[model samples]
Target chain A: MIKKSLGIALFTACFLFALCVGPALSADSVKIGILGPFSGSLAFNASEMKKGMLLALEEVNDAGGLFGRQVELVYGDTECKPDKGVGAVKKLLTRDEVLVVGGGYCSSVNIAASQIADMEKCPVVVAIAISPTITNRGLEYVFRTSPNSPMFLNGINQWLEKVKQAKTVAFFMENSDYGRDGEKIWSELSKKIKAKELAHLYFEIGDTDFTTQISKLKNLNPDVTFNIASTTEAALIQKQAKELNFVTQWIGVGGQFTEAYFKMTGPISQYAMGSSLEPTLNMKSPETAAFVEAYRTAYPDSRPGIFSSQGYDNLKVILDAVQRAGEPTGDLQQDREKIKDALEKTDMKLTQGRITFEDDGQVHSVVPSVVQVQLENCEPELRIIYPEDRATADYQAPQPWRERECQ
Target chain B: MDSLFLQQVVNGLIIGSVYSLIAIGLTMIFGVMRISNFAHGDYAMVGAYVAVFVMMWLPGPLGWVNALLAAAVIVAVAGVVSELLIFRPLLDRRTDIDMIMVSIGLFILLENLAQFFFEARPRMLADPFGGNTVDLGLVSTSQLRLFCLAFSCVAIAGLQVFLNRSKTGIAIRATSQNSRAARLMGIDINRIYTLTFGLGSAMAGIGGVLYGTLFAVYPTMGAIPTLKAFVVTILGGMGNIRGAIFGGFILGVAETLGGSYLAMEYKNAIGFVIIILVLLIRPQGLFGQREGV
Candidate 1:
């Protein structure tokens, strides 16, 4: 009886959800699905991504919407799960009947949603997720505005080669697809540089205690440690490493540079090198300055992360395609095809840099900068120290940490 | 290698002590009420938030002490509220499963509520303890971790004393053993349940504050600890406090040693594996008194 009741309750909840979010077809508006996580651990970044997309929507409408019709954004919250993302994409494609889609925050979620979009022939503009495999999936509808791991790997290798000091190395890989790619790249690169790969360690995404891992690492005593964890995990690991007096020349492929990393680790995060998409200190392009200013003006209380910037750029790319598509003609199928065709030939300059994608809808060789966590003007910031033209600061190796004073 | 071994051991012990507090509370609730109290971790989360406020409002040398007390008291109050509002209503149904279901519901509700209020971003307390280390021969132990270990031991010992000596604690124990007999002896079972819940929640509260100081305070921060607590409970038996402590340490040491010896990827998974081995060897738990069998 309890099982029966539970089934009934679940059915009712689903029915209610469908009723509440009933597909409203607007004949005078062009509908585009915006996919992102609205809940879960990643919900915070997803919300930021949403804010960026919302800003883009208003901007597009302000300067006259696509095909002389107001663009209506249909948001699909995937909650950062692969299965849930596919479900969101299904709802967007079939129920909402969206002509085009924008936004894919988490790499795993984005890849799942984009895979579905490919099957449905709906164009998807990828924002934040930077796993190279997502593009390598051979999906025609999926196009990433952000740089991938292979691109960041080049920057990382370049920086490491320039230093020429790291002969023995260790890697702390998160047991996820993103980390798997990093492990592959870093492991292969170790052979090229003839560095001793002491240990290729792994940890769960949300594991708080890194003491045990660091204890094992301390014993191995590698000269350099390559970290491939998320922003929080990276910060926590670094903080614990400092506490344990297990200091090394820290290196990260991507996903470590953040305001939270500095705030959480404080001065201890100093001199750690990592690859980043965000131009933390020096804005090479005028557009980056304007984007930052506009973001700050819009969200006074909060600071936008790299994900938010990616969201904004992705939307702009999608809008560029919509304008290039020229006319909607009130037919959803034809309008979608037109957007897809236009997106294929998308060549434009944006805040990050000149944005373009190959036939596989992936941006390769975007030239990410090797940045060091450094103190500038009494604030901790990522100072780009590689790619000489983009370098705002010089590279600094991890300094021997001072003994922590008692309270 | 010797230095690393000692460091890992110290790390395991420090982290294990915190796990013991959380597990003891969970075990106490299950022992008396037979309710799993899956939302116990969220209770810890609530306490951590309370600590954050307390620290901010009252800043000085004894600020952290006051923050800890405030966290425990506030979380204890929250615990009583959960009992009065949810558990008390479901007691008439005569089903332990109903109470467990309510706990799961409470967990989801509390997590979402915390997420709504706190957001998903992690918040950290200003380091009152700072990042100071006290070298113990071969291994350097952080002052903050030492504080967490010492506080957890004191709290657990105090709870043990309360159970052995206090009249109310005896009544609670009686209720756990024979509810009908306790009821006939004029001891209110409902009151006992409420006290047990509040006490258990307060223990979790202490764990939460320490967690916030050492690691971070976030909405979903309680998740992994809760899973580990469950594993500890299994090793210590369902509702035994002494067993919870032993089990927590055992699991912690096992995880640390396993991670070091085998693979770091198996760090979290190793504890569960140990629990499985223990279950296969002796089902009554290491400290569990064989009741019927």
Candidate 2:
């Protein structure tokens, strides 16, 4: 009886081992690393990015597994710190042995991680970090799928000239890489457009008070106040601006004026304008609509933002590159180079728009959309107002403050 | 230079008032219980959330007042519960380190629970004064900030009165001075502990409400202020109320001046540096009594 029990235990142990290690050890498998701020101030955004990437992976796997090889993703949590980001990239490259690394919601963290990828000769596909310095560093291995600050700033400038016809502008930028880069881009474009810089107010990340900054802006009194900050900071600034009776036009960038922003700031978000690389409202394309529906079905609780969609597109680009590179024959370095070359050479249409990379690894073509905040039944809705060819709603600029004329 | 200096000083005072409000509870708790509650910040966070919820339900002028009251009551209840469930049981063990660890655990638990409920969104509580600025000719200040300063002064005076006159407050002070002797003299140590915890949490709640009004409310919003409060409490000498008030104002001034002159990013670092300097100069703190005194 003892001998029979021992044999049975050994058989069970062997079965469990195989069950756990079978897929990981399979020869026809491609592994990619996803690193981001999973447990810090930016965890919510990171979670959204992860969910979107996972959904894209699921779709790719369902459609025959990336050229007959199953794609695998390994996640690294950077906690939004530069040192942690560097450590995460090392772990992904050395421990997980992933060919292509993706993820990073913060610009500083992304820059740190990208440095490691460059040193290790691994391709890093960034999803939504908009610091222009990330691409400006000229790292051949680093490629960002999201539009940089220059693209968004240029788009906003064109819209202001053609659509809004605004003359002067006020700048309220956060003191971070994303905000500073955005301000620099805006400064260059404002010079070209001959827009006056009325007030240039700056605040640190995690700063709660904005009375001083708002007061300065109110005194300077420009045509519009451009809030180039995170969603939370922008919400606070906007609310303060309204309370101070500084009823200037408010324009934001990079999906800052969304449902969450409006909810946080309450009625202050009304009439705010935001520019997004991803379509905000009236997604008319059947393919885009289908993707959105699938995403909604998968994550019923969380809504997909522009960054989430960009994350999904980044994953698709990497997976497509791996599939085109064909199966690897135990040579990871060669496979990585081939995949990088394929990523640079390919042209694919994602849920957002056409995906083609420039020589510097930035998205070549993107559809920029402008959205206006409108109150519907006491709830804020981002009504698309630009690109009349694709607009589903008419633009109604908030009546100028002069016309309202408070007693 | 004069305009910048005056502005910095005003900024310091406004920010100092906030620090004093946050550190008052820490001072009270340390004075009475001799236990450093690491979860004080989490209580502040809970108060901020409660204020937000109340503000959403009640609109206009009454909203701000109700939010403050609601936060105080909710945080007081939470403090009582924590005392009954965690502190009372740990008292018999005489394990101060274990209690500190438990407080840390509570801090993390409360922060995570807040994240779970709030989903990491930073919310702006409506400024009741409508961003009205009061220009004193020399410097300008916001109505909300002036209100905070006035509230802090009132709160400090009220606390002084309570500590001096109230029977429960006397028992708390007696327990802090000599716990074993107080217990021998027929004082209910448990009740005093509970009262101290409640009082401390109430102070934190008030701080939270004011903070939410002045700034934005987020799950991790209490962390930086809490750290600053710790520095203030330490510099003030643990258990010294007046010292805490002085330390808070001093640290605030130092931070503001540092930010204005040196670098804004290093504002938080100034508090730590002051704490280190105090530790090196006077190990017992600026206002602390000598050991065995």
Candidate 3:
């Protein structure tokens, strides 16, 4: 009877081990969380980010997945709200239990989500949030895949000095965190460039009319106008400026140089210049060409915009991190650390260019391209005219005022 | 400073004209119904969208005109439908606050619906006048600005004539003064309320079209103008028509001039301060009548 009882106990123990270790010993699955504003005012940009991410995921999966395990994406829609973003991060971490999280479009949303990541010790890869405060907070776990505001503003300043030859400047900005931060940077840079700020107009988020502001601009007659607003506001301001016949040189930040702006303002967009991290259709790079072809094939309805390219690049960075980390073990903490370490040491050549992260987890190598609107045969075109080596189109300098030329 | 001051004033006037049209509609609705239509701004947004669609379909001369007509018709129909479905039912229950709340709900609903359809991108309504600058020697002006000012004046005159000569207009005025008395005198209270709302919405729609032509149209385009309209209506006496026009111009000019001379960033704050001062000084408006009839 003792022998029989001992044999039964051994069988029971073996049965339990098989039940626990069966799935673990099989192929592993790596889950990555994507968070962004998918159902709010910035939904279009978010949607672009999603498209880019999905395309990269498809490419990665086709190439035998990340570290020979299936890479899965879990999406959380923050709707461009801070509270919603915080909630989304919590859900992705606790419920989804994703190893790596990515995608934040707005600066405020990124800040809130980054705080959550810091607390949970989960590494977050920001796709396109450019607020300087994101990095200034000194969060260890937060890594931005896109360039921060300072780098972008510094590029703008350099372009203004070397290309536009701008001296007197006026600033028009929206009164939000994004706008205020950008305004501060631009203001400081303006002084550095020896440009006098004639007027700095701050508008609310939903303001439609700018006649008053434009008229004030006309009166000041600044040599150049810096529109530090979103693409929508920039379009409206440009249209109104055209109406007032205020023919001054115009420059805008990242959000301002897009197909939507060109379509809205048309010919009036001429002589307007802006900077972007991604290349447009005019770049004609082999990597960009391949992306455009794949994007067109995948998303027939949507045009491959600059933001989409940035989003796709972000996904590639994440996949590279996962592969470099080696095969995912069932252990969550161990896998997360490996991925984070891999990201910190990323020096991969990507479609955008060679991407490497600094000590603060910010992308070190970023090429900010300056583009200007030109009237090519009565049609407005966005021509990359700065950084002559990378430019695909010719530069047309702004026609100087009669007095300035005479002087 | 002189040239800058002059330029700012000119800018203010152009902006002021737009405020006048929006404020007039809000003032009319409040004066007649004694209910603040919070959804009035959404009506403006709808108008802008309608105008944009029209311009896209019919691009050329008279595009602006077609857009104006389309905005008026669409907003009028929407106003009538709201009265029939939402406002009239609430009125029967004697729930004024509920109606106000309903208007707010409608505002959010319409804005979201607009997002679903328009996709948050700002669309430009073709400007017939284009961007021709009329150099007025000292202060420059756009032909579009001149057109906007002229349009506002004509609209005000036409509305005045309709209120004075038209039979339905007199009934609306009578209803605003005394709803029960008008009911007793055989005036259909429901009809008057519907007509007032429809007219007010039509005015708001026209304002949206004009504003879109001058600026650009987006889902949240109506919010700032809507808030300004509320301030203008309250400052001009809740139900005063002429007072709304005057208040709109005053607020617009003040904001423009303040931004130019004082601080460009504080332009909105300047308008808010004016409202507070007016409320403190004369509880009524600059042109508001005393409550005693």
Clashes of each: 0, 0, 0
Q: What is the C-alpha lDDT profile of model 3 across B6-58, one tens digit per residue?
A: 76677777777788898888888788777788888888889999988888888
Candidate 1 interface RMSD (Å): 4.4
Weakest 10 consecutive residues of candidate 1 chain B by summed lDDT: B85-94
Better of 2 and 3 by lDDT: 3
What DockQ does model 1 achieve?
A: 0.44
Pairs that collide in candidate 1 are none
The order by descending lDDT is 1, 3, 2
* Residue-by-residue lDDT tens digits, candidate 3, A136-235: 6878788887878777767667777786667798888777677778888888878877888888888875566676788778777888787877666787
**CA shift of A238, model 3, Å:** 1.5
**How well does each candidate reproduce the native contacts, as fnat?**
0.57, 0.20, 0.51
- Residues A124-217 of candidate 1 have per-residue lDDT tens digits of 8887777887888888778888888888778878767776558899988778777788888888888888999999889976788999888788
Model 3 CA deviation exceeding 4 Å by range:
A1-41, A57-99, A161-165, A281-284, A299-302, A319-338, A400-407, B94-96
Q: Which scores higher on TM-score, 1 or 2? A: 1
Candidate 2 i-RMS: 9.3
Better of 2 and 3 by TM-score: 3
Each candidate's lDDT (Cα)? Answer: 0.80, 0.77, 0.78
Error of 1 at B59 (Å): 4.2
